[model samples]
Target: MRESASWLAPGRVNLIGEHTDYNDGFVLPLAIEFGCRATVSPGPEGMLRFTSAQEPDPVEVPVADLAPGAVPGWAAYPAGVLWALGVDLPGLTVAVDSDVPLGAGLSSSAALTCSVGGAANDLLELGLSPRELVAATRKAENDFVGAPTGGMDQLASMLGEAGSVLFCDMRTLDVRPVPFGLDAEGLALLVVDSRAPHRHADGEYAARRRSCEQAASTLGLRALRDVVDLDEALAKLAAEPDGEVLVKRARHIVTENARVTDVVALLDAGKVREIGPALTASHASMRDDFEITVPEVDVLVEALLAAGAYGARMTGGGFGGCVIALLDQNAVDDAARAAVAAATAHGFATPRTFTTSPAAGAHSVGAHHAG
Candidate 1:
């Protein structure tokens, strides 16, 4: 086995679709420059050690003891990968460092797991394909971390290309890269971290998923993506008791899926500016129908729109997180200032803002050996 190696995986931002992945629908997401790195090296026999720069304590566990819910906190993410791989190997130590902000609506968890997953695949010569790695990392999250997220984040981290957004079809597991050259068009994509302590491994996110499943079952369809005649579907849902709630949930998924297709077409036609209305409409769906956006995120979106952003919406799993705004390249500063001022006036924490472009996906950065 190699003495040591390190791998890097970037966080991702969903430009349009939200809550559509789990329904086997479409999503448009791009990898961001900020990411996590995992370095793997030999450790004591029969034991695994995991450490993170962002965490206060390192965790050590026996290889046999690695199981779902056995390792807790941030360490579980990396440790879960070892469990999911279901392979026998030597003791190892993984040290991770990252610039991706936690709880900021960026896929920090995916970055962590994918980095570790890539490192393990290389160090062990596992020869796992990118799709298999995506499965392993997502399994680590869904079955181990107990987060009911779809494979969109992991796919984006694994298959992303620089200067493009990934158009993912969750049903078929197909991905195509669509060019997103905002700079060439004198445009900018701004991300505002509301710092509202976004947490998705909770009942709220699960509840939304359950609602979608229930709606799909009621329609006798495989998934919400099969809902072609949305008006008819809503009418059927609205007739049932407490169906109004399901109606709203189902509506968001159908419309959000369409919005993703719309944005992709706009980007394809090189009319990037026209995608603004779709972005705003997406945020409204999440706010009114999906009921995911927190007040601070709502304030930020409104502020950005008021400041002349072409489009703005809350990204990520959404109880609280960041807002992505598309606007003129020169308007970034003014829009950010407006968003922060609006959020703070509502007694919310001051938000952090930055501009980002599409970036490369996970790959090996370096390898080393003991002297």
Candidate 2:
């Protein structure tokens, strides 16, 4: 029997695609260095215990009483994973510590859940593949936490590789690691946390998802990814009531999918800097078409570009969250200062900024066996 074990999973940032995942479109995301770690070991009979470095209090629940809504708040994420796994097991104690910022649109929730799930899978000797873990963690977020999100975050956290970005086809669940040698190119990916709260469970995100589904159903397609001719599709949608909004939503998805492909091609050709325009264009679409970006995010994106970022855009599910800017490594500090200055000038919350490259996926960090 395993006496104890620990696992780690990283948060992610989308370089291009946004609001396209649920539409079965493509996304390019990279797991960041910051993430969550979970340590697990046997516990008292019939009881599951959880503790977090971030939270002062410890939470304990009965193994048989684990269910959605049974555990609440931060503890719910780990408890949800246990519920979704549905495996008979002895009571366990799980301890977690994380540096991934909450409400930063960086997949903190996914990292938290995946870390716990990965630890449980290994400690119990359950031979679940990475894809299976992705499914289990995603189910925990969707069914247990009540967040309406696609599997991109979980998949990225599970499959990420060092020095590579994940190119995911949401429809096929196919993922490939694309080389992203930013340091070699004298470039950096600057992440500016706007400090504005972004919540996926909120009505705004669900509403955008509903709009996409409505458009797909009206177009007689499985998802927005099936739209072959954007012009024709938009024209057809324009004839319906509230067609204007649907046209914009569909346009963003179709064009964003194309942008993902273009960015991938540029990366393949080693034209890393050229992808900046596409990143900026993505933010425009999210702001104008999807109506997801808030003033703080919008201002930061603009400031990044003005301060010489090659390209900048808001990442993750956005009502407000983080913005990523790709630029020269030498210019990173200046760009960060400019973004913070812009936010403060606009009377918005002071933004936090950091730089990171692609990082490794979830894995076991340590373990011990019972004698």
Candidate 3:
């Protein structure tokens, strides 16, 4: 309990894939510049001390008491990481600060969990690889936090390189890097935070996932990811009583996975602009078929497109979050103004707009400045 350290983990934005990760589908995501930073030091015996710039009070828990749902609220994210790692962290103090917008589908929870987990990895010398660390973090969220998100967030946060898009295959854990030079290409990635927070533990997310699972089971497959002939699968679903809902869900996952492949290929060809249609199509599938996007998300997408973005789509778990726009760099200001005006006019919270480029994954900020 002597060594102390600081660690950082970047938040992530899924460029094309949505609701597909849990279905064991492919995903294309990149780490954002915004993320969480943690300062950790040894705590008193048998306890982990936790504090956050975002939270008002300090949370303290016995190191041996780490368990699922034991540490409620935001603290459970980090605690779950410790528990999943099977490490006996008797005493550690965590101080978190983040610029990543929570509830905006930017994988802030993953950022927080990985930041603390990375710090613990460094201080404890766990010697886990990027994939292993993310797997532990994923278990923390799934089993400990009880949120059924797939491994994309953690993987992207752990393995993403600056200026690169991570083309990840959820079924295989294969990560392929695609260079992202949007800024240099005279384009900007605009994130319009609709500010309508989404909680993954909510019934809606779990229900959608369950629907996909049932569809996969009904189709005699392990997951929807196995369905190669989507049209044939759609025809098969048409005969079931509640098949329409399941079909829509399956359709979104299948098509979204396809979009991920398309976007990756386009990026590899240095055809960033061509990826726009895939983004927009992905958004539509999520909206019409998956039924995830809320009004705020939908509106922002429309605004971004109207403002001349090559493509605009919601970028998170939906039901509320941010919409991303791929547009000329010079159009960023106009796009932001348009989103702000549109949201405020519609009686929603004023949207937060910002530009981001792919950034580095988790790393230690070092213990030199640790207080």
Candidate 3 residue runs with Cα over 4 Å from true position = 197-201, 368-371
Model 2 ranges with Cα > 4 A deviation: 199-201
Per-model TM against the reference: 0.98, 0.98, 0.96
Q: What overall lDDT, based on C-alpha atoms, would model 1 receive against the true structure?
A: 0.93
Ranking by TM-score: 2, 1, 3
Cα lDDT of model 2 overall?
Answer: 0.93
In order, the Cα lDDT scores of the candidates are: 0.93, 0.93, 0.88
Sequence-dependent TM-score of model 1: 0.98
lDDT of 2 by residue, 1-371 (tens): 69998999999998889988999999999999999999989999999999999999999999988988899789999999988887996999999999999889999998999999999999988898999999999999999988877999999999999999999999899999999999999999999999986644388888899999999999999999999999999999999899999999999999999999999999999999999999999999999999899988999999999999999999988888899999999999999999999999999999999999999999999999999
Task: Select the stronger candidate by TM-score from 1 and 2.
Answer: 2
Per residue, candidate 1 scores C-alpha lDDT tens digits across 1-371 of 78888999999999988999999999999999999999988899999999999888899999888889899788989998888887996899999999998888799998999999999998888999989999999999999988887999999998899999999999999999999998899999999999997655378888999999999999999999999899999999998787989999999999999999999999999999999999999999999999999899999999999999999999998889899999999999999999999988999999999999999999999887656
Q: What is the C-alpha RMSD of each candidate to the true structure, in Å?
A: 1.2, 1.0, 1.8
